[model samples]
Target: MRITKVKYKDALIQALLFIYLIFTVYPVFLMVITALKTNAEIIKHPLSMPIKLNFSGFIKIFTTQNFALYFRNSFFVTVLSILITVFVSILLSYALARYKMKYVNPLSIYFLAGMMIPIRLGVLYINELLNTLNLIDSLIGLILVYTAMTIPFSMFIFMGFIKMVPVELDESAYIDGCSERKILFRIIAPLIKPAVATVTIYNFVPIWNDVYFPLIFIHSPEKKTLLLAVTIFFGQFQTDWSLVFSALTVATIPVLTIYLVGSKYFIRGLTSGALKG
Candidate 1:
């Protein structure tokens, strides 16, 4: 009787999860299908399947709308910023994890404090500082902003994983005549693959999707990120749903690709960090 009840409960949970998955995925399915329809078809049969796949909207966006430039800008900023954030966070986290120092705990608290306060609260000051440094309206400025914004969270993740690594590995490497850099890069980093992947995947999506920072810092039409360029599809009188869907579909590709690539490690990292931390 108890076994039957447990089986029934498991089945109910699975059914609910399947329903939830449909709710989450149906909109994305609709958007992809809608992007394949012409404007006339979309107007006539908003929810109907496309009679024929259309590539014109995608073509026009790249050919006429400077979308390629926006894509390039977003890719450059997101990738570079993530690279810098991960590199710096790894070094800092490794030190904090392994070293015994008087101020280490206080220093960790100081860095973690950034996560408690929303970075947007200091936009005025950030803007003023960027202006003072002559980095406004520049991709470099955006990269720096994104790097700073992501580092705290990245370090948090890295430190969790770094702490889980046994200290004996460092001692073994040192006895084998390995330098600190060699021990860190060769010994420690390999053990933290999941954490590295988790940090990269976590930061990648937000940085790619962010419009708030780009809108405030970038005024040049040519320098706008992909999400910023998407505003062109909106207007007061009538919205071009076809163009909007096409642009959205294009924007979704990179994020999906990154997630899929990192998903294996990402799941493991989350589980490991949760269980071990």
Candidate 2:
């Protein structure tokens, strides 16, 4: 009787999960189908599959609408921001994890406190500072803002992983004449791959999809990121539903590819980091 009940419960859970998966994937499926239809076809057969695939909309976006430029700008900003955020966050989190100082707890709180504060709340001051530094309308300005915003959360992840690392390893390395830098990079860094992956995945999606900061900080057409470009494209082609869907599909591909490729690491990192923390 107990075995039967357990089997029934497992079946129920699987059924629910299958339903949820369909719900989650249906919209993305719809987007891709719509992207393949023409505007007339979309209006007449909104729920039906396209009679034939269309690449014209995708071509127009790349060739005529300058989505390639947006792609480049977004790629540059996301990559640079991740590199800077990860580098700084690892060092800061390592110190917070390994060291024993009176102020360490307070400092950790100070960094985590940033997560509680919204970036938008500081935009006025940030803009003013950037203006003073002559960084307005610049890719560097966007990268700086993204790095600052991402670091706090990334640091939290790193700290969790660092705490889970055995302190004995650090002591052993030190005994072998490994300097603090060597201990951090050569010793501790390798053990926290999951945390690093978690941090990268977590920060990448938000930075890649963000339109608000870019809208506020960037005015140059050539410097606009993919999301900003999509917003602008939508405004210009409000009546062209097919074109809009194509642009959105194009914009989504890179993010989906990144996530799919790193999904294993992403999941492993989160689970390990959470358990270790």
Candidate 3:
């Protein structure tokens, strides 16, 4: 009787999960199908399958829109911001984890406090600062903002992974005449690969999808990132739902690909960071 109840409960949970999965995936399926249909077909059969495959929408976005420039800008900003955030966070986290300092705990808290403060709250001051430095409407400005925004959370993750490292390893490296830099990069970094992956994946999505900062900071059409460009693209092509859908599909593909490829590392890093911390 107990075994039967357990089996029934498991089956019910699985059924619910399957239903939730379908609910989550249905919109993406719809977007893809709509992208392949014509505007007329979309109007006539909004929920139906595409009568024929259409690559025109995708091709038109690239040929007619500044999509290539938008894509390039987003890629440049995202990659550079991730690199800087990870590098600085690793250094800060390593210090907090390995060294004994009077203000270390307080300093860690100082960085973590950034996570609680909304970035929007500082927009006025940030704008003034950027204006003073003449970085407004620039990719460098975007990269700086993203790096600062991501550093707190990335540092948090790296700190956890660093804390989980054995002190003996550091001591052994020190004994072997390994300089602090060598110990950090050669020994500590290799062990924290999962945390690095987690931080990269976690930071990549928000940075890529961010429209708020780009809208505020970037004005040049050629300088627009994919998300900003897509918003403007949709505004211009709103009547053609097929074209809008195609643009959205194109914008989503890179993020989806990154997640799919690094999902294992993401999960592993998250679990390890949480448990070890």
**What tens-digit string does per-residue lDDT give for candidate 1 at 194-222?**
78888888888889999888889999899
lDDT by residue for model 3 (1-277), tens: 9999999999999999999999999999999999999999999999999988988899988998778888999999999999999999999999988889998999988998887788978998888889999999999999999999989888888898899999999999999999999999999999988888899997888899999988888998889999999988788888988889999999999999988999886676556545643
Worst 10 residues of 1 by lDDT: 231-240
**Model 2 per-residue lDDT at 204:** 90
lDDT of 1: 0.87
Model 2 over residues 213-248: C-alpha lDDT tens digits? 888888999989999999988898988888899999
lDDT of each: 0.87, 0.89, 0.90
| Best-to-worst lDDT order | 3, 2, 1
Largest TM-score belongs to which candidate?
Answer: 3
Q: Tell me the spans in candidate 1 whose CA falls farther than 4 Å from its real position.
A: 1-15, 236-238, 264-277
Q: Which 10 residues in a row give candidate 3 its minimum summed lDDT? A: 268-277
| Better candidate number, 1 or 3, judged by TM-score | 3
- Candidate 1: which pairs clash? none
RMSD of 1: 2.8
For candidate 2, the per-residue lDDT at 26 reads 95
> Candidate 3: deviation at residue 29, Å?
1.1
